[model samples]
Target chain A: MSEAKTSANPLFLREEELRQGIELLFFAYRDFTSEADAMLAKHKFGRAHHRVIYFVGRHPRISVSDLLDILAITKQSLSRVLSQLVTDGFIIQHRGPRDGRQRLLELTEKGVEMERQLTEAQRRRFARAYREAGAEAVEGFRKVMLGIVDDPARERFAQSRRDGGRDGGRERDQ
Target chain B: MSEAKTSANPLFLREEELRQGIELLFFAYRDFTSEADAMLAKHKFGRAHHRVIYFVGRHPRISVSDLLDILAITKQSLSRVLSQLVTDGFIIQHRGPRDGRQRLLELTEKGVEMERQLTEAQRRRFARAYREAGAEAVEGFRKVMLGIVDDPARERFAQSRRDGGRDGGRERDQ
Candidate 1:
């Protein structure tokens, strides 16, 4: 029972109202990634590489198939990007302990540092926004984001937070 | 002010907490675009095209230079994308009335229809999320997004709403 619920207009789903939300999402996401993107450009890498490094950092021994599922990119696309990462030494593949044929992905020390740097650039925005909005607004923000993402199953960090506590709030993508 | 302000932990800036925010942003943004991305694939258009259409739709007579500034892309990149949109008949170019050489961009009728479809796919998620979160949460969500975006000067929709009422609530990058 929010005050906004009782006092706010319920008919905010009109096309115009919805358009504003769309614009906010566009600007927010664009600006959000721009910082990390600049850092990536220095390495002659792009978003594809940033994503591979990020997910590998998050999942630590993530299988190629699993990564393809999460990234929703084609194997050919991933192969091109993955090969570059391997050649450049940002990522290394390991044979699955149980399945010798499987290639599991993990980040190298250099890869980890890149991931940390990228995360740090983007994290500053979230940290500032969350603090400025305060806890209630942050809760509302996450709730709306959860709905927008439409993948509660994928947001394992949120799930983990609910089940317990203190797990470096990063998404596991597992 | 709010209950979460008092009830929630004040010290959430720890690295783990910050990292979770990063993860949520990654998943939320990725899923947010994936739906529209599917629609884009059907038309052989990518995110770059979607952005051009969306912005041109938002600002009907947006000039090329203004667009370049808003998109933060190189002239070479915008030229490739813009020419395609014009050739494909999704957009039309006009010479500025006052400035003979100024290239003004506007979406053609076909472009408008395409823009609507793309926005429709994305709007569904926001509609559901805003409704489920209630008005208060929606307010909170907007506040947080405002901070994350850090472009109050650009989000003229929120400003216009503050000045009065009903404006179809779309951002004007001008």
Candidate 2:
């Protein structure tokens, strides 16, 4: 039996092994979302609402137009979630200083707290994963995730990094 | 500047680092779903339908209750997707020999083809990521993902593994 296994090309990627990787992605993604979904449910919010809060929290002065680009969702679809968030006092929207038609969004104190709570749960999971996986694996995971982004979105993502906000950390000497 | 940075323990986990990981998960999950969503959109099917088809395809003789358990969705919600898949001839249901009330599901030829197409996109993504990361990171990714699953679902996951479905790659004696 050992010889039979050894006879196969151990280095080669098999179709079956590729299929297992696909199933792992499916199952792993589901597990990742389940925790966040439960937390959102308790707040009478959905995943759409969580996405808005998350991005707004990430970029304090992000405009709705920019948010639409980030989310890749229709304005009409985002409108419902955004309006609720603003109405609920979780997000405060102000007219853009230069672009009157654009609405700038920021989280309120309440919003920040909620965002922190929501993210804390996720962060704990990720931190544990990172610690267990170690630094190299975390780096690899980040690269893999970055590679998965679509070409156009990749450009936007890079631009987001370049246009540093208050939240952006100071440059670390490499 | 260095003194200020050194005031805090650099080796310890920080709020900023934790938040960065949170953002990465949000963005990564979004990118992961986008490929599958585009394909499902072409069929006028949503993620819900895709989930049903995927789990059934992965476990050919999966029961309705078992699927609901795996999906962690309400039966009513799953019924809508399952009914559609069945009506469209993408899935076929059979009565369990041991239990008449239990309905076991399997993909039709059409369903199998559709599942293959949907999963291929994801598989290609994982394949590239795995190869880039190498074996250790892939193993770490799997372990971390399994750890993230909540207690109850973790038990279901373990049971599913024992059942030796496609999700569970048979152990090869090496």
Candidate 3:
């Protein structure tokens, strides 16, 4: 069957090729995280810690609820990571100017430096991949990723995309 | 200074872009695994179990040592997942034809069915992404992923790529 028909119909799902994609996702993700995980491990942190530092560093002064929405995890999950970051002085949390219930998060100087190191390694990988793939492929990869996001998450993702534009996608790159 | 330089020099990485890549990795990966994780959770199995099942199913008659190599985990790690699969009748393990020390693995009928369901969700996601991204982007994504793979794992990935040629990259989907 034609590729278009096969994809559109869903009934003609090529089982074997799809499985390879699954494996690819597995292997690719394993490799993708290994570098950052090693760095976090050295710092006595875990992937959870990395996620918190990452998002907070991305949108400086972002509120707790906004972070919870972006990360799509329970407050408890975010609380554990956030508390650790705050205690360790990597992140500073303060009451929002307008909403006391909302905690605004920003990375400390040390936190910024550490986040840089962790992110730099990942950037090297992506930069290489993007360069090797070229602009067309990079755009394609982004679109594919956007398509794969779940519906609800997509809304949050879109909001981030809009906010990201104001920053010229700078926060996204971080 | 320019995009070209940033793209070309791995060491001269863009902090913002790199951070964005990290978030992309985090978000993309979470979305990527959610489908299978949900299915596995329903079965009281985690991702670890799915990995064991997937590799064994992919390489029928694969040996214990070979599996460890592919999984890049300790035998102890594989043991827990592998034993559960074997005990549950999802996989059948037999003494190697020539080497008694080596255990060869294959999926039972039930295992095959489970594998199908587990992979179908992922395949649908990938198929949609691939079609939306088009063939060029798909190729670039694969190339970028291949680049991210470390040296030791690269060989195994290459071997799989070759093996995949027979089914036109459908082995994993199956």
Number of the predicted model whose TM-score against the real structure is largest: 3
lDDT of 3 by residue, B103-172 (tens): 7889999999998888778778888987887777776666666666676655555645423422232222
Tell me the tens digit of each residue's lDDT in model 1 across A43-138: 999988988998788778888987887777899999999999999999999988787777899999999998989888777888898889898988
Scored on chain A only, each candidate's TM-score is 0.82, 0.82, 0.81
TM-score of each: 0.79, 0.79, 0.83
Q: Which residue runs does candidate 3 get wrong by more than 4 Å? A: A1-16, A153-174, B1-17, B157-174
Predictions' DockQ, in order: 0.43, 0.35, 0.39
lDDT by candidate, in order shown: 0.76, 0.70, 0.72
DockQ of 3: 0.39
Models ranked on lDDT: 1, 3, 2
Worst 10 residues of 2 chain A by lDDT: A165-174
lDDT of 2 by residue, A36-107 (tens): 789999989998898899889977878887788778889999999999999999999988777677678999
The segments of candidate 2 whose C-alpha lies over 4 angstroms from its true place after superposition are: A1-20, A155-174, B5-13, B152-174
Return the clash pairs for model 1, or none.
A168-B16, A169-B20, A170-B20
Give the lDDT of residue B124 in candidate 2.
79
Per-residue lDDT for B124 in model 1? 87
